[model samples]
Target chain A: MEWFGANSFNFEFVSSVLQINNIQKSYGSVRALNGVSLQVPEGSVYGILGPNGSGKTTLLGILMSVLRAQHGSFDWFDGRYGDGYRKKIGCLLETPNFYQYLSGEENLRITVSISERGDEADIERVLKLVGLYERRKHRFATYSLGMKQRLAIGAALLGNPGVLVLDEPTNGLDPVGIAEIRDLIRSLRQAGHTIVIASHLLDEVEKVCTHVAILKKGNVLTDGPVTDVLMDEDVVELDATDREGLRSFLLTQSLTLETDKETGWIRLRFPKGQAKLEELNRTCMQQGIALTHLSLRRKKLETRFFELTND
Target chain B: MKIAPLLYTEWLKVRRYWAFWGIFALVLIAYPGISYLFYTGYQDIRSSNNKMDAMLKLMVGSPFGFPEVWHTLAYIASFLVFIPGVLVIMLITNEYQYRTQRQNILDGWKRDEFLWAKFWVVAALSILLTIVYALVVLVTGFVNPDMALAGIEVKSYYIGLFALITFNQLTIAFLFGFLLKRALLALGFFLFYFLIPENILIQLSRWRWHTGNWYHYLPMEASDRLIPPPPYLGEITNPADYKQMLQAIPEHILISVAYTGLFWLFCFWWLRRRDLT
Candidate 1:
């Protein structure tokens, strides 16, 4: 339960940073979102995990007001935000949609104007935060894809918005660029900004996101702490002295186990906190199968993700 | 007031844009520069002794000298419609092309603010173009030998109409830019609308449809009528005829006003109705 920061810390006094009601969106015949609702507590790095066209981008678009949802509504900071809510929320949607001809600094100046914040100091600070201060003078079009994405992060950091919404922040980036952005998001979360990231890369979410919602085909299959959901299964690797007897015993038992003949291991999963090593051995002894090798193996989110999404 | 930052945002977008500076330079030169050339040419012709030259000098007597200065400046400035049209198209269409329109709204701008940013740019361009023409008129009058301070008229109404016509033309460009959202397509339609469509439609209204005087009320033609062709070539030199030619007809002015309002209505509607996808 402590996998999410919510359990470790008392957030009762800290209001919900984002509350999405039963929001829905459609594009022609395709339903991009179908009455999706979620609440994001303050100071959480919430990752939205889904395959492409699973309504992740569409959801972010509706939240940012870039695209109107056909049904339902969402509120920011428990309805504390009004017309000026955008000044407190920074978003990078899909691409680094900056003016190609203008320098990064000039583009941020436009952002400053739109946000109506008078702090010119934050421009340099945000640029430095994204490691783009050196290239702030370069035209956006001249920069590589990684540099463009960095500048976009810098733009979103302007005015010190309380929340950041990023859609596929690592899209089209090299490994190093993805890591840089990942580190940036981690630091921003450490600094107490409520960050929301929509991504399909499972490992990226597992590494950085404290909470996650798995979406498939415009519907959220499940949502909770990443550790709580993905770690629901504890994999036990076992082999017995009577291999054929172990196989038949495993088949007769109510437990589900995946047997790999080449590795001479059958992997069985128990609910978290309920996988007792002695209990498993006792079951094998009663079946007249002596255990030769038994150990715990790391369970991968990739396996669980396929299991959940494929369903 | 709240629009200041929005204007600043728009200025940053276009301050370094090539089309911005290009059209700006073109308007600065085409208005005053052409006025200077016409003034010097009039002076040269006035000094000639040939019979045709003498008649021409009387016909175009000191195009920049007193009374004639205001009309001359406004007329030359009207030729600037196409340049600002192109500039306005670039300003509005660049948002769509770059996808900054979505970013701008996400940053805190209401959809109306996005439209106003472009509106203010058009308004500023019209005012600047009008003022440039005013300065050129004053300078042309100041340097002309036949210029008389006593006879000089500010012709504020004429200048106002000139600015209005410029706004009308720029709005036409804005409408097309919003409707098409493609620079080339918008510019092409802009060129065709102003250059060919108006003339052909007017001709058809006269020859084929035989609609008496109805063509002048058409949007582009109404703006064109705001600044009528300048009096040259020994035609309509009489005081009564000259005064009539110098002022825009009230009917045409009313039509231009209606079209200007309608143009903005369509632009705002487009901004509101369309998704910023």
Candidate 2:
């Protein structure tokens, strides 16, 4: 819970900082990102939501200076490629490529050596934070994919950087691993580091991000506060043996059904202050059909994410 | 900004990387064995003819029959062949091959800064290797019981040391590595075309030569200044002995340093302008 820089709004105070403006990028004829502009606020968790091939990684790569942009520019807060600036930005633009021959500790040590802010204790602290302290001495080549990913995170954490920018940080994780990473990211944010995570997992982003940006193709679909950007309407999902019967009943009862894709259930979006669940259940029972399930679905970041990035 | 720790880390990288250690072991232990085997083969040929030039050729490995210590030293360096060139290539290319360059470049190291450190390390290794070769020659003279080996001297060792370290050789090597973005290929190209005529001229000028067939001042001929020469060269002349000649042209040290300096400037400019990707 320690913030490094307390600079102004015009000045970035996020231990991590990225400022991009109308950035455009293309690979051959494929436009990867187009006219995307965003400023990640200081000391908050920011998330990018998009579908596959939605330019999330492309944006992160540009911020890391790993890839160049055809148009627009960026500054890694105050210091744009400043001296020793990388030491302040702990970024996992993608899965890290650690030395396969080296142990987690050894790999961390090597990165720490290269970092301007390197301290020996940081190696152990980051290991502990990511819940891989016990496996610190294990060779990276022998680690499980999740453990390798954790080790990669530990590498970025070396030298105790101010901000953490992770692209798909919870990629390929089981529920437990996902929860653990979520907790770890939350803890990092509490420690006063600004974090920007780009992920296709909208639920994960919704649970953690204070701000959100949605991207589609090579364009910024929309970006803003998580609540404001995603808040469409509260919804309720209805599941039963005869979804057509339930859908007809709900439509007659004044509820709106969105898409027609049936993934083994029927879902309806009811406006706020409109669900009389007990009465609906009574009616369904009277209709001689067993109600398999009913659950109130919050206006999810995922729906907005899909809506913004669908095209 | 903080160079000490970075240098230590790079040192550890080379120390721990298997290729570096493997090569280091070969250089230290195999050189003497290889040299002895070479001489043994030469002595067999010499026995058949009873010719002194055969023995000298065995010692110096040359067709230009000169007897100076400097020419002999050049012969000794050539035995290592592309090792020095390859070592410089490995310095950056290994990092690229391993995908460690991005991390290193992002770890507060500018491209030029990283190259500069590698430059220093390569220079130091070159100096060390040259000195060791020179010392081996000195030791041979002091310890050899044969009267024929008593004339070996060790001055050109230091001269070759300067040439090897100077950016003259490494700049081109590193330049090619940076441009190709592959170490082995660049080093291979350098080694394959190393002795070719026009290629040396182009490298000598950094493709900047206006003079025609500018191969005269190349390392191939100038490198001849390093050791005892083949028998056909008229006479062996020590730098100290040729006081008048020494006074006439620019000093060997100054020219070597100037060439290195100019090459580095070109390297820096080109590196800055090119897209490193």
Strongest candidate by TM-score: 1
User: TM-score of the A chain in candidate 1?
Assistant: 0.81
Docking quality band of candidate 1, CAPRI definitions: medium
Q: How accurate is chain B of model 1, given as a TM-score from 0 to 1?
A: 0.89
lDDT by residue (A62-136, candidate 1, tens digit) is 888878888999988666657567777788889888888899888888888887652578788777877788998
* Regions more than 4 Å wrong, model 1: A1-14, A231-256, A259-266, A270-299, B50-62, B231-248
Considering the two chains of model 2, state its CAPRI-style docking category: acceptable
Reference contacts reproduced by model 1: 0.79
DockQ of each: 0.64, 0.32
Residue B167, model 1, lDDT:
88
Backbone Cα, N, C clashes tallied per candidate: 0, 20
* Residue ranges of candidate 2 with Cα displaced over 4 Å: A1-16, A80-83, A131-138, A233-298, B1-3, B30-71, B144-162, B165-167, B195-213, B217-277
Best by lDDT: 1
Question: Which candidate number has the best DockQ?
Answer: 1
